[model samples]
Target: MQPTFQNIQEAAQRIAPLIHRTPVLSSESVNHISGAQLFFKCENFQKAGAFKMRGAANAVLSLSDEEAARGVATHSSGNHGQALAKAAQSRGIKAYIVMPETAPSVKKKAVAGYGAEIIMCKPTLQAREDTLAEVVKRTGAEFIHPYNDERVICGQGTAAMELIEDTTALDIVMAPVGGGGLLSGTAITTHAMLPQAQVIAGEPQGADDAYRSLQAGKILPSESPNTIADGLLTSLGTKTFPIIQELVSEIITVSDEEIMAALRLIWERMKIIIEPSCAVPLAAVLQQKEKFAGKKIGIILTGGNVDLEALLSKF
Candidate 1:
């Protein structure tokens, strides 16, 4: 069955002790600059350095005993791979991760450090999937998708639950959109609990599939994304696209420069490090300040798995 609020709640209960309840921070400086009352859900501090842990742990733990023994396999760019590797290790299950050849070395080392086997592939989604398929077929491992599963979505929804619980009556909640796992789950949970809360998604301008898809009223595939927000390069998944289309109030786009600026702002003002992908929502707010002025807004700082050297060189 598709993930619902009930399913997400159950997942939250199941994974509560395993994951951090990460703090919700407020910044008057950010509010003053953007003219919006901002509540930041600091998922960059989450375990595995991203919100991916919620779903990865849920998917790993939900597996049948037989499936667990067979182990788990998946494809990810970085954060999800590390999350799955760590979650699988916690359950004493071996994990096989397929990552792009061009994925950040820092992330690749983290996944390997978690004791998961790594298989490198070309930078295409198709290549990653094919490699994962072969690995799963060879080892008879359970396939744990990075985003396209009900259990994964349910796990991701918990982030939204915690955000709303921490602060009440938000005018809107914004999350970065990649495969749509986080946004889809946020939509389900937020709509069920805070029906008045509008859930918006932020996408990079260079990889604006989610924004274009929402605007066109159909699934729009990204064509060779060239964005610096490496984590937001993927198109929406089949399961997540329909849910996002139904539940998200809007999908906004932010340029790569704007994303970098937002990233720098978070680091300088909040004293927190966030990757470009994680800064998309904050970038949106900065770019469209008038629309969010004087309103209570919640933004998810999705992850912090940036390569410091690359970031430094860029600036």
Candidate 2:
């Protein structure tokens, strides 16, 4: 089913009790540095340490008793795996999470700590898909795709809804686009609640499939993306592309250097630790400060599951 504003409302109701209503924050230092009034939706403080919990909770709850008993499965390199695990555990059901063997050890441990069975696969998307298929077959588990499912999209939309609810007159709403799930949902929700607000997507130049797909008018898979923003490496899915095409106004691309700069700025100014992917949107705005000067720009702080010790060691 195609996701809509109504579906997003339903998802909000379903997940209200299940997930945190993450705060929308701003920093005077960041505002001065960027020349834009930025309201950050801090999903790092969310359950499972990411916004994925909202989608995972809604998807798991939407299943039937029989389906719930059969359990749930998904493939994720990080936050989403932990999210699905938390959701399944909440219901006393099993969650099978497929992760690329190259995935960060911190994320792997997080998923396991949530009580999900971890299945390791090769780093490729094909490898994850193939392995997930086998696991689903073996366990009869209902597959809850990380971002492509309608229920998941609906749940994701609620984040934008909350942002809009908290601050009613946003000039622009932005988020990092990977599979296009969060951005597409944000587009739909922003258009629904505040039609005047423009929805933009931030994309890493190293993983620029979303920008290419938007330009080509078709989905273009990224075979190999080399970037620090690991969460934004996935290709846009069929389900998410159409919604993004319909609702999103534009996509802005940023280099890895720009992303890192934005990451450091936010960490220092806002006193928050967000991942590289989460910094993409802020980076896009900072690079285009002239365009966004004094505008109320709302950006999604997508996740915060970083290898902090290693990251801090670099600088």
Candidate 3:
């Protein structure tokens, strides 16, 4: 069940009233600097404060009555956990969210505010997985993977669908790549609907697995990521990697400093608070300004879950 434009269309219909049709913003400053027309999909303004809500809601809805009765479980760094919790609660279903202890307090509080059970683990992917597995086994909860599942990808694809619908004829579309879910989904939708448009991925240099994997034509695992973009830490998943390889045009890498600079630009110029992971695409534009000159580019501002105080202290 590979996610396609058709699946995304259906997902749009399914999650329309449940999720916000996040605004598409034009940035004059970004346009002037890059010499390109820039349209930003403001998913930071989305419900649950990120685009994860669309996928999470769609995945939860796709479950059968029996499965929903059994409840759902997933592990996330932050945004997806809150999304899943809210979505599950909408259907009167229990959600068990296993999150790393290193996850931001805001996200943990958001999940708890949604009345979902939160299980904290050590700050490692393996630890989160292990804890989530135990919770699933004990509670008989159906596992809802954050990014590796088709339904989730289909839901994610809807973001590009909305963007394309709002502003047609983009030369290139760029989004930050982490687990490759959003990038893969964006690729699938854009490749199908706007075949001429190039779909590129923006990745952190600190976690350059996606960039290396795309170049080598294979999935490369991340070796202990240490990036400021916390959301861009995961290695590409099996399902997302194949789709990305097929549909994505390229993967570009940016430094942590570049990411931070982009974050500052967004906050200072656009008056938006986007996470470092979401800033990677904008960083790519700034890094490769010559390549994008005079082109129409679409950037996905994927999330806005940054810790303001922590971010300010970094300055």
Candidate 4:
């Protein structure tokens, strides 16, 4: 069944004990920098070190024992892979993660630490899907898409549910869009809880497919997404795109340099480590501070999964 508000609510209740109710942080310095009263939902501190844990837990837990016995499988190079591995571990089920060979070794280690099997593939999306299919065929495991499935979407929405519940009177709420799961889930939850709040999405200019998709009234895949935000490279999913098209008020694009600036600013001002993907919304807001000035806004810090040593090379 396609996820609805009730599904999101149910997902929250189901995963409450399984996942962390990560803190909503704030910084007067960051607020001053962006010219907005910013509430940062620190999902970087979540179980499995990303908000993906919420959705992954819900999906795994929602499966019946018979189905779970067959386990679950998905293709993700970063946080989703780790989240699914952790979720499967909690449920005592096998998880097969199809990762690109080029994916960071740290992420692979994290997924392995959760006891999920790793299946490497070529870096292309097609290669990842093909590899995942073979894993499912051999294991008879249920396929759990990283961002496209309804259960996953509903699970992702819980972060926004927490954000809106924790912070009052938010004028706007924005999340970074990759496959649109988090952004769409956020829009669904935010609109349902705070109808007055505007929902925005941030996209990397290198992978501005979501913005183009919204304008075109259709899902448009990015031919090649080249950005430092490795997590935000995939185009929107079939299930998630419609929700984003209908609910998102604006899709803002930010450059890699702008994302880097935001990344440094947050680390310096808030003393929190966030990945480039997590910094997209803040970068978009800061890029157009005049539009967001004086507004009470919420930004979802999606994850902190990154190679700090490699990241430092950029500076």
Q: Give all candidates' CA lDDT scores.
A: 0.92, 0.92, 0.91, 0.93
- Model 4, stretches more than 4 Å misplaced? none
The digit string of per-residue lDDT tens for model 4 on 1-315 reads 456888899999999988999999999999877788999999999988899999999999999999999999999987999999999999999999999998988899999999999999999999999999899999999999999999899999999999988998799999999998898899999889999999998999999999999989998898888999999999899999989877899999999999999999999999999888999999999999999999999999999987887889998
- lDDT for position 183 in model 3: 88
Model 3, residue 68: distance off in Å is 0.3
Model 1 regions lying over 4 Å from their true place:
none
Worst 10 residues of 1 by lDDT: 26-35
| Residue 242 lDDT in candidate 1 | 88
Model 1 lDDT per residue over 1-315, tens place: 568899999999999877999999987787898889999999989999999999999999999999999999999989999999999999999999999999899999999999999999999878998998899989999998888899899999999999999997898988999999999999999999889989988899899998998889888899988898999888888999989989999988999999889888889889988888988998999999988988899888888888998879999
Clashes of 3: 0
lDDT of 2: 0.92
lDDT of 3 by residue, 1-315 (tens): 677688888888988878999999987987897688989999999999999999999999989999999999999989999999999999899999999988888899999999999999998877988898899999999898989988899999999989998996999999999998888889988898789999988999999999999888998899899899989898899999999999888888999999999888888889988998999998998899999899999999999988777777888
| Clashing pairs in model 2, backbone N/Cα/C closer than 3 A | none
**Highest lDDT scorer:** 4
Higher-scoring candidate on lDDT, 1 or 2: 2
Clashing pairs in 3: none
Top-down lDDT ranking = 4, 2, 1, 3
